[model samples]
Structure formats: C-alpha cells, structure tokens
Target: MAGRHWPGAEPLLPRLSRSANHGVLWFGAAACIATFGGSARARRAALRGVASLAVASATINTVGKGAVRRERPVLDAVPVIRRLKQQPFTTSFPSGHAASAAAFATGVALESKRWGAVVAPVAAAVIASRVYTGVHYPSDVLAGAALGAGAAFALRGVVPTRGQLPAPGRPPTEAPVLPTGQGLVLVVNRESGSATAASALIRDALPLAELVECASADLSGALEDAAERCVALGVCGGDGTINRAAAVAAAHGLPLAVFPGGTLNHFAYDLGIETVRDTAVALASGSAVRVDLGRIRPGPEGPDGPDGCFVNAFSLGVYPELVRTREHWAPRIGGWPAGVLAAFEALRGKSPLEAELQGRRRRLWLVFVGNGMFQRMGPMPGRRHNLADGLLDVRVVHGGRTPGLRLLAAAVAGPLTRSPVHAAVRRRRVRLSGLAPGTPYAYDGEVARSGTELMIDKLPEALTVYCPMTAA
Candidate 1:
C-alpha cells in the first residue's frame, strides 16, 4: 500500500526483493563483494557476517517460527499484480529474511564498523521489503530483527570480530629491570615467513643483541647453546618454533622473548609482542610477565615422546590433517582460502576418535586443549588476558548421534553455543586414553605421532616472557 501511494518506487522495491529472492543469493553477493570489492580486512569482516547469518537462520527457522506460529499477513488489501511472485508457505510471526539480514549486518558491523555502515541500509531495505510485498506484518519483521541481532551477539562470544582486542580486566604483571640488548640471544628460523625482514628490524631496534639464523634441524642445538651463555633466550618464528624455545627456556631456567615472524604467531601475540619492534621495546624496558605452559604426556614414545610442552594449543583427530593441508596449500592460495579448502577436505568422511574423557567413553571429531583461555579475537583466537591463571581450555567436538549435519551446524553456530555435538570444559588437568598406537596429534601447529594415552596438565607461572609495557 505504501508502494502504491508512491508508484515511482514500486518498480524498484520489487526488483530489490527479487534480487534477494532467497537469503542465499544476497549472502553470496555479499561474500563476493567482500572478496572482490573490499580490502583484506573487509573480506574477513564479511565472513563473520556469513557465520552470523547461518546461526540466525537456524535459530529463527527452528525456535523462532515454531514458538510463535503466527499467521502470515493477508494479501486481500494488496494489489494482486503487485503481490510477491512466490508466496511463502510457513507461518510468518518472525521473518526469516529479516532475521538473516539483521544478523549479517550486525555481525559485519562488529568486525568492520565502516563496512557495517555500508551494509546496514541494505539490510534495513531488505527487512522493509518483506512487508511491502505483503508476506509479513511490520511486527513480524521487528521480532525477526531482534532474533537476528541476538544471534549475532551470541556468536560474538565465540567468534572475534576483525582487529579485536583483549578484554579489559586486571592489570598485567609489572617487570623488574634487566639487561636490554647486552647478552640477549635472539634466534630466527630462516625458512619461516618474513624471517629476514624481522631479523633486520630486531637488529635495528636492539643492536647489541646477538642474532642467529638456523634451520629447523639446527634450531634445538642453537637455542640450547644460546641459553648456556646468554642472559635471555629470544626467538622470531612461528608457533612451532616458539614451542621449542619455550621448552629450552624452561629447561635452562631462562626468560623467553618472542617476536611474531610466522604464519600464525599465536604465542607471540598472546605475549603482546606482535612484531620485532614490540620485542625490542619490551626488551629495552625489561617488561615481562609470568605465564603457565601446557604439558602433554603420551602413553608410549613415538616421536615427541611421552613428555612435551605446548605454549599455545594441542589438537587431535581431523585438526592435524586440516593444519597439514592448510600448510601445503596456504602459500599458493592464501591462508584463509586454504583453511576453507582444508576444512572441507578434513570433514569429508571423517570419523571421530574413540577416547575416554573423564572416564566416559566417547567418539569425538576433535579435541583441543589450550594452555590458557584463548579468546576469539578475529579470524584467529585471541590472547589470554591472564596467562598465569593455570587453567586449561578444553574443547571437544563430539560425533554425537549424527555426525554430518550436527557437526556442520556447530561449525557455523560458533563453538561456544550448546549443541548435541559440541562441548567445552576448563580445568587444570585432563586425561584421555584408548587411542590407537601412533596417532598423529598437533601441538602449537606442529604434528607429532604419539602413542595411545595422553595426559594434559598445566604448570603454574612456568615461564617468564617479555612484552611491551602497554600489554600490562
């Protein structure tokens, strides 16, 4: 009726609704726009939108529609010629389209405020079109918008928006004064991404510090040698390299300094050292914090043996395969794209690992245990606000009664929500057994074949790590 009063806009309104005929088409278009028409950050923001849409659609179509069961608005007053081309068959108390649009727009805005500004108007227009087409009441759309926005907020707890920061809480631990660059031994993995550049930056910032370039084979020896004579052990590499440094530092009773130089510098970022320059500042200021470390003991020796430590996270089952596939294809296709491909490949015909969790037998798709609570920041998991809390974040993806649909649902819904196939627990110790001998597992991004049993425990305030004063 409003469109009829404003005849000039009627033609375009229908066209817009038709373009978004199904929520999928509009979301696909949004993905394409994010990928091709925006910056890298915008592309990441768009993915969060996609995830929020999935969660909103599932919640609205299931609970929202089933609970209310409101009748659709009658089209008797609508002009027959102007009615929706294809009428919806379901009850219309809450509009699914409006829910999806609102969820996606809210999710995107959480990631990129600027991109959200661009998407909000379009989402609003889509919600309005539902009523203009005579399929929904204004009240129905309003309820749907609320549902969608709620879904987006729910996911924000598990999925971080782009460039997200650590949540505010207690102040970080202050550090005592120490040597800046003198007697500092910094090690770099030459093969790791941008190592040369990172090394140059580190040297420029800490000219008195000694820099050593080593390959994966020589890494352990070089670190041990450095720890013997140096006041501090520093490393610029990926999670795998950082894991090694942590082990050596712990054994030698030396403080560790890390610079983010790898594809995923999860440990370094958690320490508030995102770049070599940050490391330099931390070193000069002698700012440091004590953090806990995760230790994993296997039933029998395979490669890394019964004793090992992870500074970040540990995973078993399809996760290791996903990591391997991502590494193989990341250089050619890019990290995020490769991860998408890897996820599909890993999930195909995947069988859950049979294990005993807390003495209950269960079949699970993946088991992830983090050294400390790792929050969702952006595309990657975020830094732990309290690294020395001495707690482990254990997440399990269950096969449940049905594997395929349930697993897929949990993935899109974000890991924090309740699902038949997903669960998370926090503790200081977790034990698992009944694994086949020589099962492959990933810790801090490196895969290792280990024996059946696994014991995970946390060491409180195990190591001291240097970081910028601002991190405190």
Candidate 2:
C-alpha cells in the first residue's frame, strides 16, 4: 500500500474511506446539494456529477481492474484497526475511489465553474484518502484519476452543461429609437422565477414606467388592459407570457419592451435584454428594433377564423406531448432533466402524424415553424439576426422511417438545421392540413388545441419592440 509508513494519519483516512464506501455518501451529498440549491443549474450539475461517478465506477470495476488483474496490497504493514474495514477486494492497479472523485469533480466543473472549484479540493482529499488508507498505491490513484477525467471529457459531447443558451451576435450599429421609460407599461408575472426580485429591480431601474403584477390565470386580460394604457408594453416573464404580451401589443399597435424575469428567457436574451438591468439600459437609451411574429389562422374549430400569434416558434405532433411532460416534471426535477425525460417518454412507441404539406399528403413526425429565421443547424436551434426577414423557418421530420430512428438521426447529425432528416426551408406562408380535430400544438412554450387545417404566416416588421441598440 502507498501510505503504510504514515501510521499517524491511518485512523482518519480509514474512517473517511469507510464513509465513501461504494461512493454512496458522495452521491447522496450531491443529491442534497442539487435538491437544496433551488436552481436548474445546480440540479444539472448534480445530475451530471452523478452520471460521471457512475461511468467511472463501472469502467474501473469492470474494465480496469478486470483487465489488469492486479492483487490488492497485503495488510501486514498496515495498522490493525485501519486494516480491518479498509480492505478493498478488487485489483489495485486503479483505485475506484480516485476514479469516482475525479469524475464527479470534473463533471461538475464542466457544468458550473464555480461549483466545480468548490468541489475540487474535496475530490482531491477523497483521492488522497484512498492511498492513505493503505489499500491502494499512489500510482493506482493517479491512473484512476486520469481515466475518470477522460470519461468526463468524453461525455461532454453528449450532455449539455451550460444553462445560458446562445443568442444571435450583436449587430453593427447602436441607434436609439424609443425614449426612456416614458409611456411604458411593464407587466410582470408574479409566479415566474425570482419574480419579486425582478419586479423590484425593474421598478428601481425604470422609475417612470408603470408596473403591474398579475397571476397566470389573469395574464391575458391584464395584458390587454396594459396594452391599452402604454405606448410600449413591457413584458417580464417566460416565453409563453412574452408571446401573449406580444399578441396584445401588436393588436394595440404598441411597441414592446422585454424584461427577462422568467426561467429560460430565450426571447429576451436573443433581443440582447438578458437581465432586468439590460432592459433598463435599453429603455433609458431609447433603443428599439422591429421583429416578425408568426400568425396562425384558425381552421375548422373556429367559427369566425380568429388569428392566433406566437413570438417564438410553433410545433405539432410529438412536441406537444413532450412540452406537457416537461412542464409536469420541471417543478420537481428542474428544466433540463425534465426535457430529457419528456423527449424519451414522448418518443417511445409514438406514432407519426399524417398531414398535408402544401397539398401533398405525407406522414410527418413533427412540423416546426419559427417566427423568423432561426439557427437551424445544431442540437438546439437559435434566434435570427434578421428578425424582419419576412421568412418563416419551417422544418419537418418526415416519416420515412420509425419515429425513434428519425429522432436518433436528429441527435447524431451535427447542425440539424440543415440535415436531410430535417427538411428545412424559409417561406412566407406554410399551410398544414389533415390534422385531426383538436390536435394539441405548442407555440412559444404554450400548448393549445388547434383546428385541423392551419395557416402559418410570417408578418414582416409587424412588431416594434424595445431592445439593445447593438443586438443582433
């Protein structure tokens, strides 16, 4: 064993080794951190750490120890008390404790640099303790550490760590088009993430602006009333809330101000208004831009053919079920995990949708339409720089094969925005027919039952909104 000469530290190291037996204690601690942190980032880091440890353990126990077939060090020189419970029956070429420690630390670091930094010292201690307990050699711990780190790096290709999503690059100019906070009505969703803090921040930043806080049930009416009162309607919520606010703002001919106050503020980030402070700066400088919104004309379900609007994207088929599952699990398990779980559940044994694409009948797994041009090439599609391009980024997954196989292709294919499995094009208008009556659709994170036939159109420069002047 590596540390037999250092008898003075044997007692502490042995006890620490016992506590980490099978890495159960460490996993439990990580779960606690994730559960208590109360944020999606923390939860994701915890889950990734657990996954890393599992990979490391499996590799070391199954492959490393088995392949090497090295024997554990004899305990003749080890302390009597320490030797009793610290004996590891597995081969000694690579230490499992060291592997788990390195794997978890590296995995967490990949997710959050700050949390990773905090865990690094603890992981180092655990790795050192393995050798100190006289069960493994120093070289064994080093080799295990190398293997664990390598595994974490390799897994990065499959799992996403960062919570901050990418947005469009900044445009070239900085021009102000709207005045500071004057005639602005800011409506905040009280139930959204950090709502109280965001509301306070917004009020402090834009003192001249009128502020309203409303529950989700009353959101539509509150938005309608707020739109009637201000020159520019400011919305502080998630994508769904922003979508509704956009519809009201467009109807009332009001420019919109987006303040990021909800979980996953995709639209606000794309507009270069990542925080309440950013919105404040943009409003103070009178910065604004014009973006396109997608208009969905009602089909057979509606008697009057009323128009519906979405600010982000719209999709039918598997996505609607996935969204529902994600929303149901998000509150308990956090966002990213919920999304992953939902994708699997929705894709399992799912049937393709039968619809007419431009009058041609086809079997489709999903039909996606973006408000404007979106980055269509990666695992996650992004926002467009030319928001007023008057083109809808339409993508469809044809049912040429099983739904599972098509989804797998999408996952493996890099830059799916242009993949063959993903039939994509930019169009001003797209008509989808042959949908069953009351088929659920997801638009901007909100689910609704729509009519069989749907007419989706890109209204060019239809929405003028407050944004950072240099936003892409």
lDDT of each: 0.78, 0.77
Q: List TM-scores for all candidates, in order.
A: 0.64, 0.71
Off by over 4 Å in 1: 1-180, 300-306, 331-334, 376-383, 400-404, 412-418
Model 2 residue 155 lDDT?
Answer: 77
Which whole-number lDDT from 0 to 100 does residue 288 have in model 1? 77
After TM-score superposition, the amount by which residue 378's alpha carbon in candidate 1 deviates from its true location, in angstroms, is 14
Question: Number of backbone collisions per candidate, in order?
Answer: 0, 5
lDDT of 1 by residue, 46-88 (tens): 8888888899999987888899988888888877666778888
Superposed Cα deviation of residue 199, candidate 1 (Å) = 1.5
What TM-score would you give candidate 1 relative to the actual structure?
Answer: 0.64
- Stretch of 10 with least lDDT, candidate 1: 167-176
